[model samples]
Each structure stands twice: as structure tokens, then as C-alpha cells.
Target: MLLQSPWPSRVNDSSTKATHVFITDFLKEKGVSTLDVLVNNAAIGSECFKETFDVNVVGTVAVTWANVNRVLR
Candidate 1:
């Protein structure tokens, strides 16, 4: 379920959460136990100030720490 968007391929907080969980779940399902790279790729612009924080700051924080707590060794 790929999204076709002119908005470009930007990762957000929700996506970060989803991605981290997706990888973790995939590893669990396959009985694999190792995590090397966890990319927190989310972005925003100056034009949308509020949205920037909502997406970039808050979203990143929530996702990053949640991922760490859930996936870290």
C-alpha cells in the first residue's frame, strides 16, 4: 500500500512509529534478533510552523523514544 503523492516522500512521527514497529514485528515474526539501523527521517518547513513542530518535533520525539524503549537492547 504505497502512497502516490505529489507531496514527496516525507517521513513523519506516525510513520516513524509505524516503521519502527513494522521492522520490530518483522524481526519477531521471523525469529530474528538484531537491529542495526533505525532511521528517524521526518521533516517539515518554516512556512508551516505549527505543523512543523507537530510533525517534526513532537512526532519525532514520540516515535524515537517509543522505538528505543520498545526495540533497544
Candidate 2:
């Protein structure tokens, strides 16, 4: 139950940062909650080294970090 996911944007897209911020902010505004298991489902296969790491690894970590300690009690 992550707030934001960077998988929507193409791999290596810088806009993912903004999306993460937006989702976190949205959750805060509405008093949303935090998440436990972050399923890294959305990933793109690549023929190069950079794309594979950026999408599957970097993006997944970035999105998951945004949800940490964001739960409102």
C-alpha cells in the first residue's frame, strides 16, 4: 500500500521524484496510513545495464522509501 509508485513513468525518468513527493503529500493531507510489504511488481525489462537497474532497483527503492514512517495515527 505504497503512496506513490515510480513504475508508471518510463525507466530513468526524473519525474518519478516529483510523483513520490506528490503522493506523500497527498497522504499527509488526508491523514492516510503507512505500508508494510512493498511489492515491487512494476518493472521493465531492458537490454542495457542502466535501464535494468534504474527501473527495477532505483525506482523501487525510491517509491518504497516515501511510505516509510508516513502513517498517521
Candidate 3:
């Protein structure tokens, strides 16, 4: 089954440690032991480089790290 959960609307919000924990916890609560794939498509086009980088890079890394263990090889 493909389970899709709502992510934080703001990239900055989604990048936080708390958000990471919430994602994993949500999955666990839903009985998801493993994931076949992960798609980090959260990004934004902004005049502020920091904002863009935070969402595109830091956010991706944070989310990936949070769920890496649950992903299937």
C-alpha cells in the first residue's frame, strides 16, 4: 500500500528535527516498517538563496536522514 501523509507547507518548518521525528512516528503509527522509495521534491524558487537552499538541500537531507533506516535496499 502506498501511504501518503501531509507534509508541512513551509520548507523551513519541514526541515526541523521535530518534523523529522513526526514523520517517522507517523509512519510507525501507520504500521509502515519499510519504504520502497523516497522522493524529496520539496523545493522553492526564491530570491533568497538561503531559503532555496534550505528547502532544496537541507530539507532533503534532514528528511532523508530521518527515514533512511526505514527504506528498503
Candidate 4:
């Protein structure tokens, strides 16, 4: 089993970029140079549609772009 420890952060907040950077650094520290897969699974539920869009859509884009280089082609 590929167990990954969760690092939870508010993806809709201003700290999103910083969070991604920190995650990248943390992975580097673990001797991980490239990511074979990335599962953007966090999503703000339907109770708030705009928040859902912000977190699920924009947040996914932000995090993905931030780690683009670290992903395996």
C-alpha cells in the first residue's frame, strides 16, 4: 500500500501558494524528487457552490501549476 500522510490546508485562502511550496519542500526532504501521481481530492462541499468552485477548480489549478516541474512526465 502507498500510504501518504495528509497535509491539510485551506486551498481557498491566501496561503495556498505558500502551502504548495511547503509541500514541495517537504517532499524534497523525504528524498522524493518526482511525483508519479497527484490526487487533488479535497473539495469544499455543495453547501457553498462558490467555495466549491474556488477550492475544487481554482485551488486544483494553483497547486498543480506550483508542482508542475516536480511531476514525472
Report, for every candidate in turn, its global Cα lDDT versus the true structure: 0.64, 0.59, 0.64, 0.66
- Give each model's clash number: 0, 0, 0, 0
RMSD of 4: 12.6
Lowest lDDT block of 10, candidate 3: 1-10
Which regions of candidate 3 fall more than 4 Å away from where they truly are? 1-47
lDDT string, candidate 2, 1-73, tens digits: 3435753433333588875775566567658666444434355344554677688889998977887677432
The ten-residue window of minimal lDDT in model 1 covers 1-10
State the lDDT at 50 in candidate 1.
74
Segments of candidate 2 deviating more than 4 angstroms: 1-47, 70-73
lDDT of 3: 0.64
Residue 43, model 1: Cα distance from true site in angstroms: 16
Summarize candidate 4's per-residue lDDT along 19-42 as a digit string, tens digits: 677667757777887778754546
Tens-digit lDDT track for model 1 on 1-73?
A: 2334555344344687876676667568667799776544345444666776588779998999889967776
Query: Candidate 3 vs candidate 4: which has greater lDDT?
Result: 4
Candidates' TM-scores? 0.30, 0.29, 0.34, 0.33
Greater lDDT among 2 and 4 belongs to 4
**Number of the top lDDT candidate:** 4
- Clash count for candidate 1 is 0
